[model samples]
Target: MAGFHVLTGSGSTIAHPKVRRIGVSDILDAMRSGLADFWDRPSHYVFLCLIYPVIGMILLTWASTGNALQLIFPLVAGFALLGPLAAIGLYEISRRRERGEDASWRYAFEVVKSPAIPSILAVGAMLMAIFLVWIFTAQALYAWLYGPTAPDALIGFIYEVLTTRQGWTLLLVGNFVGLLFALVVLSTTSVAFPMLLDRDVGAYAAVATSARVMLTNPLPILLWGLMVAALLVIGTIPLLVGLAVIFPILGHATWHLYRKTVVAPPERKRRR
Candidate 1:
């Protein structure tokens, strides 16, 4: 098929995959399918869900035992940036299940030896970098607004944050900056990882294809992002337990989203 192609080290070339035009209804359909997948094999997904609460508890303990109380909200918000990494296993499950194979949860933890590992790790590093920078930036914004020191106590700090102009300013600016970071990540990886699993393409190609899909279907992509934000906020409200359910649903749904939005390359003949 005639389209764009990327040259490989072996002097051969592979055609670039195409992005599909998706709609708001497609996004909803993916989520619905993801939820069904979870219920279909709930036990397989249980342990993965527990991971979030464990991490939350550890963070809570660290803040309680340490002086870095201000780290709490920043860390909480940082989850938004790192959410993609945590969903890797769910992606695998979705992939396997899509083929009508047994979707055992154990496969989620076993070592993944696919050629896509390097690209997956590359994307993971990118996410962690964003998360660390976000933490530092959040701390600086807090220091600028409140003072050089974080609030001595959690409750007092909460009070000050609610009753001060500095807090409001910091909140507004911080959210704006975070939104930019999120959009960048979202645009870059919206379908990148899933594509990696579905195809043998390199990370750069996958990323470009992901962004292409968004541009091809802007309205649906916008609605999908908004829906993700709302779900995350709602999931965070119930002491983070909602994350167990939310994570798998979104993770599985994301696989479907990638499948729906990105078109695989058509097989072609190449000169040997």
Candidate 2:
């Protein structure tokens, strides 16, 4: 994970963030390094984590009073899709700390002014689209399996899903569909987000580069995906507060992964 293994394969309009084969160790290392960055400014990540709960509280209010219980799971999964955007700030923090420079959260916001803004915004839109699709698909799956109406009581709904035979079907189908969407989001955004931040490249090129990274390192990439999913689920266990640490760690880890896996585009030799 420390040194680069430059990939010769090409994928986009311009391959600025050169691809490389990565292994399990690299992923873990990146995550560990990410955790290190989170501690570098724990207050910032705490702020990020707290902000997420207000939305969840609103959703909880809706679920308590309405039939919108189906929306909850997707919102959780959507966190992974949206992590790239959220991590932009963390990426900057990590970038600065790496260079022994000032690690300012406000400075991280300046990433928007980078020339990569168009590409970053484009990828952000793609993540948002996937999140919306996941939400609708989740709701549709619920309606198909358990009818459009959820139980008036949250405890009753949980009991039904856990104890009924139809509930098993719902879990099976819902997880299967969710896995499909997760793979799509993971493949496209895994390296693309960090790559865009580190390089000057078009959005399509950045996406293509990320796809190539997964293609070259399939098992490890899938492992990383599962880790993110697991972290999100675990973080939700404690009133969504654990996410304050976990989210930033993952974001910082992503930056490390990008540095480890992507070889910079080689400089063209000047003509004699």
Candidate 3:
């Protein structure tokens, strides 16, 4: 089915893409296509995504010292919330390649010049707000269970978490809370970013469309979310270095997934 291009009061055309219900196989195909895109220029993606692991390492160091030790898990887990923002450039790269255009790494920054940048930044801000709230919620959850005082060192905190009842409770409740946040991020953002890239729809409409996609195809979207979480865990295991590969693949995959989930606006016919 074709989507609509609605003219607004200000005469701006807003594309409301039609949503499609997808399946497990579609998700797999998207990832496969994404990996192929990454392999087309692995070095470029690596250079683009190196900042991910560096940021992870910084968060690890920050959490390892002082009272921030308790934040290590939260910092790592919170990556799901912010990962989409990090991948905006990758989406552009994939989109360019798909259209048979030049997809050099520098072109990734072309998003900065897009008319949709403001909307993209608005959505990005919303994600940042969620990330901040998640961090605060993580801290509050820990404080409620074990008080404001963090352990003297990383190992001591590890012992407290592994050997104590409150630690067990924290792990259970904290992960449960984190899951809720991840789901919200997944439902709202799975298609939003890429849709924004492909269309000039406002942030509100893009987010609404993404949520609609989630409702229309819950199982596949949730499965994709779980897969992303699993891969991110593996990526972080090698001291966060693996994300140099993992993030780009997921990033490129997300663009392909968006293509599968949303129908693009029809082309305009030229008059004879």
Q: Give one digit per residue, the lDDT tens place, for model 2 in 57-156.
A: 6666665667677666666766567887777877877777877888867766768766566777878888999989988888888888878776676677
The count of residue-pair clashes in candidate 2 stands at 0
Q: Whose lDDT is greatest here? A: 3
Output the worst ten-in-a-row residue range by lDDT, candidate 3: 1-10
Task: Pick the winner on TM-score between candidates 1 and 2.
Answer: 1
lDDT by candidate, in order shown: 0.76, 0.75, 0.86
Backbone clashes in candidate 3 total 0
Q: Which scores greater on TM-score, model 2 or model 3?
A: 3
The candidate that wins on TM-score is 3
The better-scoring model by lDDT among 1 and 3 is 3
- Candidate 3 per-residue C-alpha lDDT over 1-272 given as tens digits, one digit per residue, 9 for 90 to 100: 01122111112554466899899999999999999999999998999899999999988887886569899999999976999988999999998898888999998888887666777887899999999999999999988998888778888888888899998999999999999999999989998888777776777778888898999999999999999999999999999999999999999999999999997768722111
- The Cα error of candidate 2 at residue 26, in Å, is 1.0
Q: State the lDDT of candidate 1 residue by residue for 1-272, as single tens digits.
A: 11122211112353367777877889999989989889888766867777975687687778667878887887787887888777888888888888787779977753266545666776678788988899899888888777777578889878777788877787789889888878887888888777766665666677777788878998898788888888988888888878878888888998999989876546632211
Give the TM-score of each candidate: 0.90, 0.88, 0.93
